[model samples]
Target: MFRFTDYGEEDAIRLCKELVRIESTDPGSYEGRISEYIYETLRQELGADGVRLCRSEVLTGRRNLLAELPGSSAPAGSGKEEPALVLICHMDTVVAGEGWSEETGGPFSAAERDGRIYGRGSCDMKSGLACALTAFCREAGERRLRQGEKAPEKYRTLRFIASVDEEDFMRGAERVIRDGWVSASDWVMDLEPTDGRIQNCHKGRVWFEAEAEGVTAHASMPEQGTDAILALSYFICALREEVAKLPEDERMGRTTITFGQITGGYRPYVVPDHAKVWIDLRTVPPTDSRMLRELLGRAERAATEKVPGSKFRILLTGDRQSIPPCPKSRLLQSLRQAVREATGEEAVVSLFPGYTDTAVIAGTLGNENCLSYGPGKLRLAHKPNEYVDISDIRRVMRVLRCLLREPLR
Candidate 1:
């Protein structure tokens, strides 16, 4: 019957494996290859004019792939036009760190075992991307069918955006918003792995560098130079104390600080004149970059004051704005209904503990009609032997199928 539901488990598994086989890691890496593959796939389905590869001028070789499919016209006498729906996915995965070896298979091998696909990006997001892409294509084909066989009116337009640089700065998502690729009426679904649940709220992230400056001197004359390392140590301690006082949220969790990296001193013989520590802060609502910066300023003032003749500078590295939990919206209601219809179970509504590109899509972009719902376990992301269950992939596809059919309903 040429039904959209024909896009099944095997298809999703195959597509996910193919995507995982390509190593699209972040930090000095680009999403050109993966974005091109997606563009070609959509072009083959909807012709060249329907798909486009948008490269960012700021990030060379990093690309954002976009595909659009127009929906059916409004029914006669109804005079109601459907709102557009945007399917969003990131094209980058965290760096595949050490621990991947031949014994466990390569990170990009995409090996199948125990009904799961083993690879670097499998659990983090590639499976979710595959499901979204396949569902979009399936619905596009249905819209192109003969007149008598067409379905009822759904969205005004279906737009799929595979954005780059999500694992790092989220500049790809910012570009999409700056370019005005979406509007207030468009509902955005960031297909990040949520294990099988639907996520309406998530924590935000702010990264900064704390630099401690001191005088340089020979190691033998330790008292002659203000030790930058010791000054930074004092700063770290003060930062710990400041973060401890922040309030906690039951769902979104508490604001926490992580000292990711530290660098100082040239050699053992010389007291370093400069030292810097990278701090990553995970903040809940009411705790944004500005508030966090103020806390850091306090820490810096306390530390530098304690260690006389030492100066500290707080530089913001990156920020993902925070938003409170959204009220009951049409998009969330439709997604919950889709999950219920597809899995025969009420969707589990919860908050995403970690950061996601949804922060940019919903918070920075000012598009409140956004949520994260997809396949794979959130715990498995950025870990060794990351994998996504094939059954989960199929379930996500089924939910998306229902979403495409009756988005507004």
Candidate 2:
């Protein structure tokens, strides 16, 4: 068993601050620089063979970093091997937009105040990344020190995956699964700033674009041409009414929809010929792509019937399935015990309201042994002047260290 001191809390905090200073915003640097930094850091500690970069096919220059610590073979004649544990953390952050107080020292300042580290991605997840990195490096270093000393205790293989593009499409996670880095039997965990809660499930997410086309007409002409903007507005109202009819889930609550972006007419003197809206839906169980398509079809028919010349179409942008709660999960039980041992407090099990890489990993592999547990609060993510408590980072490190020390079943 490994002690908490094996990975110093102070070291984890320092690494978190350093990571916060790097501007690895999504759609900006796109995790290129941060991936390189992590790759080089792990290579230095675990050697080049233990760490490698997997470039993303969808995004240029962006890559995922994988670091592995292989475990000893099971005892002779056991006829079974321990399942591997995959720890995932994304290296990208949402853009650090304008608004910030002077105390924050700008978006990439990595400033410290009130025992918290402030900057973009500090709370969203850089702190969790630091904890994972520290724990992995420390465990690898310890193993190296104990080489050739009798028979080492058997442990599960540990894989640390630093993915890119989690803030946008989760293309990095898709690539990781496609590349066979994670198996169906392996347990997956994403460090996604869950406020130290053990989140075993998350809501489904679907993003689609609705385009409405109509004939342009002069402002003085009434009923001469259908208004594309009015048609899309009618569709939006119809969709909301349809979604309101969906039954609410006990754990995940009701499915909700949000209009993220809308573009319509440019000038006031003319009726626009084209209009579009980007819709985001947070879905519950029993809601799949087929159901979504039907819902959109109904709404489109409603709009077309109301506006004679308007034609509507939908383009799906992204889809991520919801993960249901696993109350009897062995991984959940083990993690809860580790949390109790590390913090002397019971772990609170809840559903993560937002989607995470664990959702993609679990859904793609049909693996129920997946969860999210980490430092910082989810509310702080994607906001300016974001910060993570230093104590929270230390606590997560302690909990993760305890969990990693135990043998996987």
Candidate 3:
């Protein structure tokens, strides 16, 4: 067992500041430097064989770093191995837009004041990354040393995955699966910004684009040609009405729909012949991928019925599965215990409204033993002047220390 004080507050805050300084924003930004930093740190702590980089397929030289802490030793003569525990942290941050210079210094300033670290990725993720990395180091340090060291004790193997592209297509998560870093029996924890709550479940999403086709004509005579934009509007209305009727989930609340983007018409003078609407459908349990696709088909059919001669096609973008709430599990119990030990109160469990890479890893790795728990408020992520409470970061470290106290069996 390890002490909760093994990793201190000062070191955690310092590392978090260092991570926020690295501009790993998405869309053309590369996670190479941050991944390298994590890899180098883990390699130094766990040795060369214990850490490796899982390169991304879409991004050149981009990689997801994985580190393993095999503990001090293995269970004696059991022949059966302990279930592995995996910790996941995303390395990318959203694009830091304007209006951040004077208000919060800058997106990458890593400025500290009044017990908060202000920066672009500070709250959204860097804080979580720091927690995961620090926890990994502490666990690895538990192994028996060679020089003047006592006999090693057995503990479950621990793994860390610093993934990339979480702000976009999630290719980094796919890379981990391709590299075979995850296993079925492994328990996974995604260190997302949760404001000290334990998120055992989250709503999923089905993203797709629907294109409406129509006949074009001069703007002077609107009746002479079919307006694709008008047809798309009809479809959107019908979709909203249909989604409003879907049964609400007790935990996830409701199946929400968002028209993220719409594009049509080259100029005002001509009636556009084609229009496309990007739809984001938040899903819950009993509403699997196939059901969502069918619902889209029905919505399209309803739109065609409302506006004759308007043909449409739904192009699939993504379908992330909704994670079921793990209300009763040893890991969940352990997490609650950790929270109480750290803060003298039980963890507030809640449903995550946004999609996370946990779904992708769980689906691909064939393990539902995954959840999210960490520091920072969920609302502050991706906003201007983003920041995470330094106290919350320290509290998270204490909880992690408690959770990592003993090896999983």
Candidate 4:
């Protein structure tokens, strides 16, 4: 067998193909075996030159890959010194969906057709990981100088963090955020698939659950006990109506609410005595999660008033997303300039509809001087035939490389 890293650009396509070959289908882990392959490749093929692998302490169920390349021992960032930059992306994809395309052999089977690399997660995220790693390696190789030789006066470091658990739960981002694990990097760049546009803002997320309890009563004797299903249903409808009334802002888009999950009592002979439901909400900027806590409180009250015989309670217990607003810092301007120069396209800045690890780190860092962009196409993510254009991959690689050489403002 041959190593994928030793091959040329043509070889990288095949490497991606091989990656798609793994049946990573929810074997209790999102990254599956492919992440382990990348981890091993980074350690062996990429070699020890400037690469440091740090495992994720928060997510031992799945691991995070943190790689840092120290540019120089210089202390300051680009005003008089260049500041360090961190590149962030995730490693997990949503669990495979059923009724998938047969030709792709259930999503992981990578197939090449008409200049596209086809497979699950090929677009949603895995390709962006390749883009960042390739840029880091190419930049390092190009900047090497002899012991006595002096390279350019650049004095910044670059860190790449490949995270896990971004699909179902955001614990990966939450854990890192709570720990303040990142060294004070001058800035953060989330490499999400944006079709080359810079993603500057993203909406915040909230996940909520409600439970209704009632005394069990036989189907033949309805008057003997209360029905929990009635109580829960009342809350569900009222909550949905309230969510529809959530305020909408012109810039960040409207608030969104969805009934993600619901459950009721079992067996046909007995009336349902207990029920629960999960609600997920997306908020425009400035809509604090305190709003959700209040909303749940209101729903509990509404259910109790509607159904006296039954007990009703609600809990807002899930990972909520922190917003990273559009930054106006010099580093942001530098990035935009590099992006425009590389693509000849003006950047379109907007908030991401989904959550990411960058939000966590940015929140803990206590600032909005952060930004995220990537090569993965957003529409095809987690869909039937997920794939990323090879051209986008090369274009982003060039942009990241150019960013290393440009003088910071």
In model 1, the Cα lDDT at residue 366 comes to: 69
lDDT of 1 by residue, 1-409 (tens): 0112456666777889899988899963567788778877776666644444344443777778777775554652365656678898998999888787575588899999888899999988999998888888777767666335546444557888888888888888888887776666678888888978888887788899989999999999978998899899999999999998998887788998999899999999998888999999988867888888889889988888888899988899888766667767688989898999999999888888777766677887666778899889999899989999989998998898888888344
Ranking by TM-score: 2, 1, 3, 4
Q: Candidates' TM-scores?
A: 0.92, 0.94, 0.91, 0.88
lDDT against true structure, model 2: 0.86
Give the lDDT of residue 96 in candidate 4: 68
Q: How does model 1 score by TM-score?
A: 0.92
Span of 10 residues, lowest total lDDT, candidate 1: 49-58
Q: How far is candidate 4 from the true structure (C-alpha RMSD, Å)?
A: 3.0
Runs of candidate 1 exceeding 4 Å displacement = 1-6, 48-58, 73-80, 101-103, 149-155, 407-409
Q: What TM-score, to 2 decimals, does candidate 3 have?
A: 0.91
Give the alpha carbon lDDT tens digit for every residue of 1-409 in model 3.
Answer: 1123445667778888888888898964668777777777665566654444334444786778777766434562465776677898999999988777575789999999888999988987989889988887776665534324564456677888888899888888887777877776677888898887888787877898999998888999978888889889988888788778777888888888999899998789998889999998888867766876777788888877876788998888888888778777556787888899888998888887887777687666657677888789989999988999998898998888888875444
Provide the clashing-pair count of each candidate structure.
0, 0, 0, 9
Off by over 4 Å in 4: 1-12, 23-27, 76-81, 145-148, 151-155, 175-185, 319-324
Model 1 pairs whose backbones collide: none
lDDT for model 4, please.
0.69
Model 3 sits at a Cα RMSD from the real structure of 3.5
